[model samples]
Structures are given as structure tokens and as C-alpha cells.
Target: MPDGTVPQSVLEIRRDLAAAYRLIALEGMDDGIYTHISARLPDGPNGEKRFLLNPFGLRFDEVTAANLVTVDETGAVIDDPYGAGVNAAGFTIHSAVHMARHDAVCVLHTHTVAGVAVSSVKEGILPLNQWSAQFFDRIAFHDYEGIALNLEERERIVADLGNRFVMMLRNHGTLVLGRSVAEAFKLAINLERSCKAQVAALGMGLTPVVLSDDVAEHTARQYQSAYDAMELGNQSDPEWAALLRRLDAVAPDYLG
Candidate 1:
């Protein structure tokens, strides 16, 4: 590969995915070493159905671009510089999305407190705010079926998340899919914020005002359009770059 070529693209994806893991930790959204964030490689030396995933047993803050492992669709390690394996549960959920959703280049899953709380509620992701409105009628819900250890659950999970970017795993956490790492991270951030706000409002013992259906629909469309436009751009998102800078200042080893 030349100077600004194949290896560069792979490195960029690794760095962005690693940055996402660190940012999740920085935002207090990580659940120790339980959750996972993965990015699909455009084309691997083996094939295109390869992805970069965080190695099991490493904390999010401990993840680095160089330490991330390359795995196939079946979660088999194709190239692991650290000789680390992926979490079985993580592979189940992420591989299902990466295989079922062709447009999903990145899959982010988290076990945040607020997200799990909201998922456990009957009325998941209430449209209490503009941010919450974006997920109104758009987010998918998959009933909890234990710890996602079975491969059969993948089909049902995909069916539940049909044509939607966000999915709340009942009694579990949240799952977000994106065409890029930036998009997936942004969605995860917003989804978590929405959950946090809803939880905070409910805890206050005050009945929150819900947005009208028409208003929520309009807002969701606007947000989706903006996201689509951002995806069409040639350069990486500035917000992603800024987040990378923040990581560089603190946990610079993420790109090691």
C-alpha cells in the first residue's frame, strides 16, 4: 500500500473505533469491561466481512488502535496482534447487526445505567425532549432473552431492529448501528442522553409533557436528514476529530 492508502484507511477505522471506546468510558457510559464497540473493515486481506473489535479482558480506556483485533463474520480472530479474543456475547450481538445490516459499518453497544433502566420500563424512550423525539417511533425493541449467548437470537434481534439504527435490548442495554464510527458514536451519545434525561425527569415525581406525534415525526426527519448529509461528506466529522483530540490529551495511547 502507498502512503495515504489501504493501511491508512484501516488505521483510521481502528483509531476512530478505539476513540469511541475511550469516549464511552470518559462519559461514564461504560460498564467496566462488559460492553463492546466494533467497526467493519471496508475490505480485509481475507475478505470484506471482517471487523475490528476490542479485545476481551481490556477496559475501554486500555484499548488502542494497535491492540484491536480483526475478526471474521463468525467472530473468528483473523489477525490479533495482541493475541486477544473477543467477548462471546459481544460477537453475537455485533456480528448479527454487521451481517444483517449491510449499511451498518459500525456497531456500538453499551450497558449504561440509564439505558438499561429505560429499557426495563414498559414505555421505553419517552419523547420527553427534542433529543428523545429523534428516537420516537424509530427505535427498535428486542425483548430480553437472557445474555445473548445463543446464535439463534441473532435472527430475532435483526428482525426487531429492522430498518432502524437504534435498538433497546429489554432488561439489557442499548444497541446502535451506523455507517461510520462517528455516526454510531453520536447516536449512542444522544440515545444515552435521552435515557438519562427521561430517568431524571421521572425521578423528580413530575409528569413530563410529551411532544405531539406530528412534531416528533418532523423533528426525527430533520435529524435524520442532517445525519444523512453528514455521512455523504468526504472528510471525517469535526466532532469526531474534536473528540479524538480530547482523547489525545488524556488517553493518547488509544491510537498507539
Candidate 2:
């Protein structure tokens, strides 16, 4: 390939990832310059993998397609036009899943208020609503291991994630991954809302009506099947499309 030329496919991934950042900001899931979203670039013919990650210190609202940086599997910045760098902790978490799960091409992480509150609970992601049910028995829980800057934590992250698409970082935040930026966005947003619902219910300080085990499992299967079809069909999620359209109206520069 040319020295400075980027593949058109990677350009598309850049746009998708940038759009996700802006949407995360718009949806109140972003935590200033912290918490990052990343998308995997296509592997080279020699089997080298690369990724697109948001630059550290740049708020999600400030992200644009052309501003995203390229990084290697080792989390080294390869093509950072702005030299803003990526969050070291972000690299640790995102790279673990990106390397461990080929199907998880896009990873979304958030440090929302509700997410952190529920992360401390021993019972994680209860089936308080249909949204919560979608993650029933499918959410991984990784004990908060301090700041996550330690390189050794990567193995533990991958081990805890263990084929799960959603996870709670005990006393920390949340992590979600998917085959596409759109799918990851959908999962992250729902998980956020579900966390909100749980927090709200618990705050009521009354006996909450939780779903039965059978119904929770059945509900989870329903959502899993729907997402499975979306992934297997190689189609964009409807909600993602609609959100992109909405973003176009408010933040069209995401595609730049």
C-alpha cells in the first residue's frame, strides 16, 4: 500500500467510530475526556491488526472522523494526526477484548453515574425491565482492579469478559462490545438505560418486582436472537441508522 494512503474501508470505520463518540456524548454517556470507544480496522494481508481510538483529553463532542487515531495491537499510536494520544487505561481495556474476541470489532466503555453505582452491587444487572432482561445472565463482572493502567490487568479483563458482550467493572463502570460500531452503540446505550432503571428502582427503597428466572432468560433469548439476526445479516441496526440520521442533523461533521 502507499505510504500515506489509507484504505477506504478504514475511512468508513473512522466515520462510524467518530459518530459513535458524538452520539455517546449526546446521550450523556461520555465522561469528559475519559472513557473511550474503539473500532477494529481490517487486518493486513500479513495478519497485522490495527484499531481506531479516540484521542485522550478530547471530549466526545469534539471527536470528528478525521481526528481519530490509528493504533497497533500493542496500543502504540501509529497515525495520530493531532498527537493527542489515547487514554492509557482505555487502551488496556479495549485491546484486551479486541485481541481476545474477533467478533467484538467495536468496544464501547462508559463511566456514567448509574453505571458506577450499580457496579458496586453484588447482584449485577438485575432483570428490572425488558432492557435489563436483555442482559440477563449475560453480563460479566470484573472486580475493580484500581486504575487499570497496569498492563497485567489485560489478561484479567479478557478472562472476565469471557464471551460476554456486556460487563460491569465492579466499583467502576461498564463495558460493551459488538461486531460493528452501530451494534456496540446500541448495546452501550441500552445498558446505560438499564442501569438507570435499576438505580431508580432501588432508590425507591421499596420492594421491587423483579422478573422470574424463566421469564428473564426467555426475554434475554429474544433480544439475543434479534441481535444475532442483525449481525448475521450484515445489516445496520435500525436504531443506529435512525440515530445517525439524527446526528446528521445536529452534528454532521462526524462524517468528516
Candidate 3:
């Protein structure tokens, strides 16, 4: 039901999405063999939906552009993993999100230390400071229902995600979806930092000062533009470039 020439710009997206996986590993957001990141492939000439995602059993740090697996929305392999099939559980969950949210071009899911810790908290993420304040009124929580293996679970996940960029998978981990790999990576970084800050603040045994409603709104607005502002600096020091460098150092093969 979609028609348009597949843009050449998509090649850049593939490179960036691959870079994002490496960066996620460099940032300590990867969960060993778990968690997956995906980007929707532009529709083909025949109106088919295909997507690129990391292969099964591959560590995030080991992922590469050439090695990224391509698959249809129904969990069928379109391009061989440069080796084997992708994780069905991971692809199923990611594919559901892509099928339901057309605006979501890049999907990132993680089970990092701080994110999982916060997910277990009864109050979830709090607006205790600037970092957390940015997400004060923007987060959505999905009560955990095992390891996300069920295709049936996608309905509730989509319902809970709605239009928010961040979702706390209660008792499991955190999932961040975005229209671009950079946007999704940025959201994941902020959400994880916010959660880490919360855990650290609470560990100090001191009551934290919470942000006011107006300030929270203002901060969130600033963050919405933070990506652009950060890129205004010299290209050599651009945050995305810096992120890629970090990935190169930790997982050099990811750009392949």
C-alpha cells in the first residue's frame, strides 16, 4: 500500500544503523547475546516490507554493516546473515514494532544495568534532576510478561508504547524507538543515563530534589534540539562521529 522510489539516502541509514550497534556496545548497553537493534528497509518495487537487523548469537560489538541480516516483516530471512539465521525471538519482537509504527525506522532495545534496575523500581524513573526531568512526562511502561517471545505480546507492547520514544519493559529491560538511528541511540543514551543517575542518587541515602513542572517541560524541549546543537560543532568532534570512533575502538568490525 506504499509507493515511492526508494531513496539513495537509505544507504547512509544502513551505515549509521550499523554504527549504532557498535556504539551501543561501546556504551556498555549490550546484554551479551541478548537485546537487538533494527532498521526498516525501504519498501521494495513490489510493495514488500524488509528490514535489517543484527544476526542471531552475534554480540553487539561483533556486528558489522555487511554482516547485518535482512528479513521480511513476517520473520522470514531475506538476506542470509552472512552466515546463519537471526534470532527468531528478537526478530519477532522487532518486526512487530516496525509493522505497527511506520514512523519508527530504527528500533533499539537493551537490558543494561541501570535500565533494568530502574525497570524493577516501583516508582519507575523519577524527575529528580535535569537528566531525569527531560523524560518526566514522556515515558511509558509495559508490565513484563516473560521474555517477549510471543507474537501475541506485540499488541500490548504497541498499545503501551503509543507515541512515546521510551518504554520501560517492566521486569525485563528498556526499549527505545526512533525515526533515525542517531535519534534512537540518543534516546537510549539519555534514558540509560537518567536511570543510572537515579540509582546512584538513591544509593547516596539522601532525599533528592525533584524538578518543577515548568522546568521539566523546558528541559525536555531543550533535549529535543540537543542533537542538532551538538552537531553544530566541528565535524571532527561531532557526537555521532565520536560515538562511531568509540565503537571502532571497541568493535572495529561493525562498519563492515
Candidate 4:
């Protein structure tokens, strides 16, 4: 039996993970329950590592805190109150990052049209806007090896993502990692916006102005400084809070 403290922490993680799934759906970043957003649980049976994932076959909007499944490192469904199994592809992609990147408490992946469009291109996300500038030289790219169902591919995926917070899955989609759910969701939203802006610029049949390397680096530094300032205050991010309020109004059941 688990201690009293473990269940509360698990519930909080579940609520955050479910909120991430719903927020992704709200932003149109979901791919029909295909993509996943996973968060590490604080404790598990026998102190083993575990994470929370959306139950397979549920649309992002349909995922509730109570329905998320608890899975072990090897993708086994250790505890699933809703009687849903885990998705093989989700396990394959997420486990690799969670295992390799201890700093990454949350891993959010998406398959939006713009994200996939950018991923399909050889150049990946360009430094076309402030949002894009933030990812300048910070994003990694992993070649798509068909569907991510084979466990062996996890090694290569981890290698490609080495210490980077954002990744472009070549010809596939986008993945963002962060030390917290707020950080991961923020990165994912910015990445998607960057990709959308790039696609729009390319669609205009004119070359987008890419910022100089120095300017891009400066902009990234500014963003990082702002993030550091925010963290120092120990306050919840206003943007993340706003999104949660939106969820409260439209999808309160995500906390159920």
C-alpha cells in the first residue's frame, strides 16, 4: 500500500497532465488522440518510477484527471482506473525522454498541421519571429523511423534530443520538454506559433527575413532572463493561469 502523501501528489500531477491535454486540444494542436503529454509521478509501487499518460483511444478533450493511466518505465500499465491501455507509440516516444532527461518533468508532443508542415521541411523552424527566435539553435531534430512503436528507436530519439528542451521529429511532429507542466506547455505553444508563422510566411511566396545570429542569440537571452525573473518571484505564470481559467470555464471535468 502507498503512503498518504503519494496519492495527493499523484492527483495533482494527473490534474496538470489532463489540463495539458485539454489545453492542447483547445489550441488545435491535438491529432485525434494520437499525440501525448506525459508527466512524471512523484512515487509509485515499491518506489519505482512511473508517469501519467492519457488513456489510449480517448480524445484530448475527453481526458480527465481520473482517467489518466499510470505506466512504468517499460510501458506496462501499472494502474489504470478507467480500464484503458497505453498506446505503444506514446510509450515509445515518451519513455525515452523521461528516462534520459531527468530534468524534464513533463514531455508534451503534438501533431498539428503547421508543426508537421515545418517538420517536413528540411530547414525546420526558422528564426522568423520573436517566438521562433527563442528556439534559435536550441531545438533538436530526430529522423522519423516510421511509427515509434519499436523500443529500439528510443535510443536514437534520446540521442537526438540530448539536453534540448524542444525537438522537431523529422517528417513527423514536435516535442517539447520542461521541468514543469507550465514550462512544457509554454514551449509547445510557442513552438507551434513559430511553425504557423513560418508556414504563413512561406505561403506568401516571399522569403522570410531571418534574424542575424547575434540578434537571435540576444533575443533568446532576453527571454531566458524574463523566465528567470518570473521564477524568482515564485508566482504562477499569468499565461498558464489564464489558460487554466479557460479550461475551468469550458472543460472543468479535466480536473475530475
Q: Which one wins on lDDT?
A: 1
* Model with the higher TM-score, candidate 1 or 4: 1
Identify the runs in model 4 with alpha carbons over 4 angstroms from their true place: 1-8, 229-235
**Ten consecutive residues with minimal summed lDDT in candidate 1?**
1-10
Score each candidate by Cα lDDT: 0.86, 0.85, 0.80, 0.84
Model 3 weakest lDDT span, ten residues long: 1-10
Per-residue CA lDDT of model 3 for 115-203, tens digit only, reads 99999988999888778887877888899998788789999999998887788999889988876677688888989999999999999
Candidate 3, residue 73: CA error in Å? 0.6
Of 3 and 4, which scores higher on lDDT?
4
What TM-score should be assigned to candidate 2? Answer: 0.93
Which residue pairs in candidate 2 have backbone atoms (N, alpha carbon, C) closer than 3 angstroms, thus clashing?
A: none
Ranking by lDDT: 1, 2, 4, 3
Per-residue alpha-carbon lDDT of candidate 4 for residues 84-167, written as tens digits (9 for 90 to 100): 798956777798899888767789988889999999999998898899999999889999899888789989999988888899
lDDT of 1 at 147: 82
Q: What does the lDDT read for residue 248 in candidate 1? A: 81
In the range 1-256, model 1's lDDT, one tens digit per residue, is 0012112377778888999999999999998888889888877555558889989899998989899999888888888888768885678889988888877878999999999999999999988898999988988999999988888999999999998889999999999998788889999999999999999998999878989999999999888777776676634467877898999899988888
Q: Give a tens-digit lDDT track for model 2, residues 1-256.
A: 0012222377767888999999999988888888889899988668788999988888899999998988888788888976888876678879888988877778898999999988988988889899999888889889987988888988998998888888899999999997778778989989999999999998999999999999999999998777876766644468767888998999998876
Q: Model 4, poorest ten-residue lDDT window?
A: 1-10
Which RMSD values do the candidates have, in order?
4.0, 4.8, 3.8, 4.3
